[model samples]
Target chain A: MGILEVKDVGKRFGGLQALGDVNLSVKENTCHAIIGPNGAGKSTLLNCLVGKLIPDTGSVMFDGQSVLGRSPHEINQMGISRVFQTPEIFGDLTVMENMMIPLFAKRDGSYRLHAIKSVMNERQLREEAEQMLEEVNMLDKRHMHSASMSRGDKRRLEMAMCLIQRPKLLLLDEPTAGMARADTNNTIDLLKEIKEKRDITIAIIEHDMHVVFSLADRITVLAQGTPLVEDAPENIKGHPKVQEAYLGEAH
Target chain B: MFGLDKKDSTLLILVAVLTLLAPFILNPFPSDSGLAQFNAGYPDLMQRFVIFGIFAIGFNILFGLTGYLSFGHAAFLGVGSYSAVWMFKLLSMNILPAIILSVIISGLFALVIGFVSLRRSGIYFSILTLAFAQMSFALAYSVLTPITNGETGLQIALDDPRIFGGAVAADGSIPVTNLFGLEMRSAFDMAVGPWSFTFSAGYYVCAIVMLIAFYLAIRIFRSPFGMMLRAIKSNQTRMNYTGLNPKPYTLAAFVISGMYAGLAGGLMASMDPLAGAERMQWTASGEVVLMTILGGAGTLIGPVLGAGAIKYMENIFSKINDNVLHGWFAFLPDGMEDAVVWILHPFVGKGWHLTLGIIFMLVVIFLPGGLVEGGQRIARAFKGKKAKETSEKATTEPAE
Candidate 1:
């Protein structure tokens, strides 16, 4: 069985049938990409998987456990982390402090009240956070306020925050949505490096064909809330159905 | 020393010293001098300063840390006062049981209110808390008369049974609130030359408690939990997705601050054994909010400074009638003096709130970070001037 299994999932928001009978399976230790045009229910599907929304029908199982009816924090505690469309790092906190939060969550469950113990004296956690920052090449900027950082740096910091948890499954909803060419290439290389070094399963939803072709082991093209095609990246490149749905009928 | 770093420890020590020496520091002007009217060392006013300091400190813990602006915290204070008065009547005249019972009861009240109010956030949460407090005020004034003593308020009666201490004093008046035969009204007067300082036992007790509260607040502000609260304030959505629950953390902060307010109320009743429903009015709640924002909401010492400043102004400004204003501006030309008094007339006497409102406006607009930021700006300007002078001297000396 795959690490994350979705079966016959369906969702509706009032009059709109956002998702209808969708099924997806992401294998362990592999990068799976979901590519679709605008308004194809990519975000809705991601929300369903992350417990931000409950599917009207069917189930989402992570590591053979049902992930439905749980909170976002609970799903995160179960070793699933998500990178949002926009970076969601704590803007008011320093980068080092931002990194410490996910580490604290991983080490001490979701809700532990360590009120009396000073965060300053948590030498082990501080060192771990600093080491994570170093790995992201953000050690120098660790003391700077995160909100003042550039967009590329914020995304990098956010990725570090998620990865520090060592989540079993990482969900990326357009990790490099709006970026300069250099930053986009940097993110692609960083994801490649992460894939080479870690035993993680990444399920990314992307609109960028370059990002999809570079990192995806398996590609699924979705259109109008249903999967149009699912195949290996090389196989999906010349698929007629995908071209018709995503690229439009050019030529 | 109490899990505090060097800077924090020093701050705690400074605060302790200031509170311990308040009687001396606040009575700088001599009793016979013209400035004697400005002296804030009197027993009644001094006790109030410390008591309200405790109140503001507690309010800051919630509003400062979590960015949750509660508008009904006075209900907790009122609850605390009623509990303390009940303790005095039923248990004993000893202040210990009264204070303890007040804190516990107010904590429970906070739990119920916080649990319900925390379900909603922002203005809804504020409105919910306000509604709960107003409901409590109405009940205490009407339906809950037997327990709260209604409009007359809860006062120690002559026939009350004292379990630990005597029911009545030798003179047959109601026994004053005391700690092991040390009366809360007891005061010591010291005369040095023309200046006279009055130190009250009650003021010292309240001041020490305020110091402890302030120290505890400093620890909370620096703790991991405090970080979590700040994180919540920064972004609740990010916090939730980061695998941290924001509700329980905010509720805990709310309850802690409520207990602080309750402790202040208990101290107030201990100093003057009376519990009135008017203490729970929405305006009283607004006063603590003003104190926190005016002093510096998130800063450790800001709330206390704000509380002291407001209370001091309340006492001193309310005493200034047109006669006082006229006397101060008498040196000016006759027409100018009258003009000055006309401009200042609406800001003194019963118009002290108008002055407070204008000051609040100025602080909110110019010093968004409150009085703490204002002080920091002044210090930085001085330091900058000194640095410029030293740099110029070094450059000129090298040129010569």
Candidate 2:
């Protein structure tokens, strides 16, 4: 059995069926990519996995446990972390302070009243945050206010925030949706470094074939809210069904 | 020192020295001088400065840190005052139990109110808190008459049963609130040349309590819990996805701020043993908001400064009537003097709110960070533009 198993999941929003009878499995310690057309329910499927939306009829299992009813934070605490399409760092906090929040969450659980102890006193967490920044090349911007940073810096900071959590599963939604070529390549390199250095399973939804081919170990082609094919990138690249789905031609 | 960094320690000490020497600092003019009208050294007004300081400090924790604008915090303050007065009536006139019990009851009250109000956020959260506070005020005013004494307010009675202390003092008057044996109303008068200062026990008690409250606020600002609160203000979505629950964090801050308001209310009742339903009015709640914003919402010392400025103007400017305005313009020609006094008339005396309104408007528009940013601008102008360190500090979050 794979680490993550989705069994015939379906979702509806009002009168529209967003996802219909989707089944997928992700193996442990491998990068999985989901690529599809705009209206193919890619976001709907991602939301269901992260507890943002509940599937109307199906089960989502991460590891051995059903993750259907868990809240977003609870799902996160169960060793799953997601990077948003937009960089969502704490704009009103310093970069170093932003780095320390996930560390505190990892140590303290849902809520801990560490009101009397100063943040400066968390010497070990501070060092851990600094080390993470150093690895991401954000050490120089550690003291800078986060909201004022460039978009690339914010994305890098967001990536560092997720990586520092050391989650068992990492989910990325359009990780390089609006990036230039250099930044996109930089992000690919960073993801590669992170995957190589850590025992992590990554699931990415991407429109960019370049990013998908460069990183994903397995590609899942989704069309009209159903999985069209699940295979290696090379096999999927040459498939007529995949080409037709992308080019909007008659099959 | 005291688990604070050097800058925060210095700010704390500066506040300590200022509050301790307030009698001397506030009363800079001689008693008989015409400028003495501006001196805010008297016990009654001085107590108000510190009491309201504590109120604004607590309000800042919730509104400033978590970005939760609560418009009904005065309900907690009113509850605290009522509970403290009740303790005085049933128990001893000593203030320790009264104050501690007030904090706990206010905390519980905050938990109930915060639980309901925190379910919504932004303007909806504010309106919910405001509705709850209005309900509390209405209840305290009419429905809860038996306990709250209706419109007459809750006051210590002469014939009440006092198990621990006198129902009535040895002199037959109702017993005054005290800390052990020291009376809250007692004061020491000192005269040097033409200058006279009254060192009030009541003001000192309120001042000491305020210092402790301020110190704790500083600690909260520097703590990990404080960072979580700032994170909530910045982005709740990121907070949730990072595996941290924002609900419990915001609720905890609400309760902490409510307890601080309770402490202030308890201190107020300890000084003057009466609790009125009007204390819970929405206008009173708005005043603390004004104080927080006028001083600088997130900065450490902003609320205290805001409180002092408002209280000073309320007392001093109201004391000025047409007579005082006439005195200042006495040397002018009769026609010009009358015209000037008439022009200045609406801004002073009973119309001090007008002055406060204009000042608040200017501050909000020109200094969105509040008075702290105004001070920083003045300092920046003095130090010149080459001061890169200060400019860098300005770029950072104005949470200090």
Query: What are the TM-scores, per candidate, against the unseen true structure?
Result: 0.98, 0.97
lDDT of 2 by residue, B69-121 (tens): 99999999999999999999999998889999999999999999999999999
* Residue B175 in model 2: lDDT: 90
- The fraction of reference interface contacts (C-alpha pairs within 8 A across chains A and B) present in each candidate is 0.72, 0.92
Over A177-213, each residue of candidate 2 has an lDDT whose tens digit, in order, gives: 8999999999999999998999999999998989999
Error of 1 at B325 (Å): 2.2
Task: Give the number of the best model, judged by TM-score.
Answer: 1
Indicate the residue-level lDDT of B372 in model 2. 90
Per-prediction DockQ comes to: 0.80, 0.90
Which residue segments of model 1 deviate by more than 4 Å? A249-251, B332-336
lDDT measured at residue A7 in model 2 versus the true structure, 0 to 100: 95
TM-score of chain B of 1: 0.97
Q: Write the per-residue lDDT of candidate 1 for residues B89-182, one digit (tens) a residue.
A: 9898989899999999999999999999999999999999999999999999999999998999999999987786667888988899988778
